[model samples]
Target: MGKKIILLLTVGVLAAYYVYTPLPDNIEEPWKLTWMIAVSKTVAYLNLFSEFLGANRFVNIAALSKRQEVPPTSDENVTVTDTTFNNIPVRVYVPKRKSVALRRGLFFIHGGGWSSGSFALYPHDFLSRKTAERLDAVVVSASYRKAPKHLFPTQFEDVYNSLKWFLRQDILENYGVDPKRVGVSGSSSGGNLAAAVTQQLTEDPSVKIKLKTQALIYPILQILDMNTPSYRENSHFPTLRKSEVAKGWYDYFTTDRSLENAILLGQLVPAESSHLFKFVNWSSLLPEKFKKGHIYKKPIHGSSDVAKRFPGILDVRAAPLLADDARLRGLPRTYVVTCQYDVLRDDGIMYVTRLQDAGVEVTHNHVDDGYHGAFFLLDLKISHRIINHYIDWLKENL
Candidate 1:
């Protein structure tokens, strides 16, 4: 019996090791990234067993969490409040150190393709807490309902509405935050929401808060041009690929999954937008350095039938890249981080050029060794270096 048990355990370990996706030497922390991807993929395959057993999966990928757990790590000088505003959950982090003046404020949105990540997750908690302690600012790590279950605009509404609640004078004062010194930030899909929310807040008349800055780390700025230079180059990048990221958006916005394969080839935009594409085509916004000599061909429109199903992907709120020049000009000072080996690399680069053209102050850090999901785990020096870069920028801007 003991020999059989040992044999079974060895086989399981060997299987997990064997299935790890190979990584190129150029990626950030290749070994660690491979291990993390292996674990996530293993969990994903294990989930398929539930379908065969005629029951829901034993684990909910969207809801996988351990809110009360804290791993052994550095930095313990922040106090956290797991609370809610406007009925949306938020994890607030305030530096424990005493201060005479109100500190800068930041709203952090966690990202797992907009369908995963939460305050219950440790990476987010650590990042938010570390931000508060390092920058000596108050950080509100907000949570929104996930997608495919909640549908489009609900997550946006939740984040924006709760933002309104947080910006109230009473709440800002109570948290030792300066209303005039507040900024927004997020990672990946959270980066998408942070950018969209920052753009929408520019037009909001009901909220008196003036955003001081925005930091988008590997944000998904547009849904249309899946054929951008980085997209062509990094579609096969580990963990977050071109199709997997678009699939999350598709699942979140609509019930139909047929658009999955078509959208991957940049074929989902409505045919009626030819006049609009001239302004947004790769030639206009993206810089030549980012183009890397890739010839610019206009996107092929999806069939009218394919276009009819997901008409809203082009909405500025859904794809901040679609926002008008006037609105983009009105945005606040911006900070953007792009990983060289990421599908979203061109998204950040294009936005930086667009924002700079509109006279908005911009700070961009292009990490040559970075890839998508690089700092998400916070298990390497490279991740901390990225965090420090943001901290230094926040010190100057916020």
Candidate 2:
């Protein structure tokens, strides 16, 4: 009888903890969503064990799981090499089959919210290899100096310097790459870097080897406002919770934790930038199909206080969404992909709108059933399809 009573107490405690433990805000869904929630919660709980090391160290440590050694190439179809260009480490993939003409080049940047990612990371390593064979292009998978240690523009500078080197006659000749057919592409924060690089190259008179196109897959383009439609709708979405978005930016851009609450409250930019809000404010920018009875709220009025603290947050390279119309004009053709269930969905949509407004040619792909970090789940059938579609668009444009 005593054993039975103990068993009942254990069951009650377990049920109560499962039911009441606060989860990062997420939509209550059935089976698949439940699984996603479970995975996200598990990561969060596991991360708590790293309290002794601090959250930043915890993030870096957790990221180690995503890193694993991958071969340079699968077979003779592609030849791969890991080398540093302008001191930035890169994974280069060259198709073994000789091309009738010089092959197109793809400069790829992997994404891990600007905090963690590498060629060793899955999907990145696999994606780079597959892109070389599928597109018959020389793929340069770039690895930049990571953040919270290296800091903001340092990551940008690494990619920019590598791009300049990649465009050199010696580099192109070695890879049999066509200078005019080069494309820059990246996923998530890497997408943000790709956009910034495109802007820098487009505006620089010294840059002669211009990109033919750029592909941004589920990029985070702005930190100015976090109350967009997607943010509200996907606040609790599994892979990248909306609540974590601004915090990620804070961790990446500044060590000042106090500014986090203000940024989260949408109080970074001054009230004068109100006119600029329309371009990125999702209720007006996102399609009616996405609205679906969703109500729009004006962002809380901002003081320039946080902006003063970290002024680089407002730079065009840091927040391409804030780039002037003139700056965005004459950009290379752009391909943007947004996942339906991703927190950054509106970010991609708003960017497309801004690109179109600036007279840039853009191809937009929306994955209705996709989730944030879905590409990481390459073992899943849907991920394969998403990747194929992305490659198909690249094939058509490049």
Candidate 3:
């Protein structure tokens, strides 16, 4: 009996080692990496189980959170309110201090790959309130409709509508915010939506209330070329695998999953749109330092037939990287944060380059030890410092 028990224990230990040892090189700490791997695998398994049960996995996971458990208003000097903008639900955070002058306004969108993120989530909730107090600004965190339920343009519409609503004189005066000092920001898919809003406003000069600044945190700015430098480098990184990233875009863009396989394999670029390739081609855009050890090959022609079926993939609002240079000019000052290990790193870098070339003032911050989801790791000393730096930059710019 004792010998049998010892053998079983040995097998269990070996299985755990096998599962957690082969982490990506970018993750420097072994203990943290192991914990992250375990958490990721557990979530994956839970999501699979939820799928089998025919339930919304994200909603189920979110149900477990302690809702609105942010720091007390008295302590944080921030007031939190739940409200709706144009009938779309939103959460607003305002600093309590009375101001002689109107404060800056920020429209913050949460990141969840256009699906799972919610302001109700602890990190986001705390971050919003903390931002309002720390920056002494009126912060509005939007809850836009997600994809696979509402579809492509719906998500963008919600965000755009909310921004317009916030800029109204009545709303601006009520929150002690200056209309001209308003800015838009987001992370990941939220960043994509923020860029879309900025692009939309830039194209239509008739809009009276213009944005003063834009902040993007490791945003997925474009989908034209999936073979970016960071994409190739972190292809199978556990935090966010390249295949999974492609699937998220596919799910958001199309109702049918039939074309997903082709899309993932790089067979979606139409021949007529080939000229657009130069904007996203890694060989042309990325610095030599990022392309050192990675091999570059000519991408096989994606089926134009498949590409024609999904025209929105090329839309400037959907792929802001393709926006005209003229449209990029006379826009707000921008702040772009890139993570060294994130698959979306090059997307931010390319955006900064374009913004600078267009004569837009840009402040680019690259977190050397950061990963795609590093912002969620508030407990880690490194992540905490990075988060502080990000907040500090926002305050200074505001």
Best by TM-score: 3
CA lDDT of each candidate? 0.81, 0.81, 0.80
For all predicted structures, in order, the TM-scores are 0.90, 0.89, 0.92
Off by over 4 Å in 3: 18-29, 53-76, 293-295
RMSD to the hidden true structure, all candidates: 3.7, 3.6, 2.5
**Backbone clashes, each candidate:** 0, 2, 1
What is the RMSD of candidate 2? 3.6
Model 1 residue 15 CA deviation (Å) reads 5.7
- The weakest ten consecutive residues by lDDT in model 2 span 21-30
* TM-score for predicted model 2 compared with the true structure: 0.89
Model 1, range 1-398, lDDT digits (tens) per residue?
Answer: 99999999999988867766766676666677777777777777766665567755323564345433454333469877778999998888888899989999999988877776676587777788778888999999889987777776888899999888989999999998999999999888888899999999989998888799999998987877788888899898776787788788787777687878777777867678655564357777776777888988788877777756676676777788777789989899999999888999988888888889889999999998888877666887688899889889998999
Which parts of model 2 have CA positions greater than 4 angstroms off? 1-40, 53-74, 272-275
Error of model 2, residue 96, in angstroms: 1.0
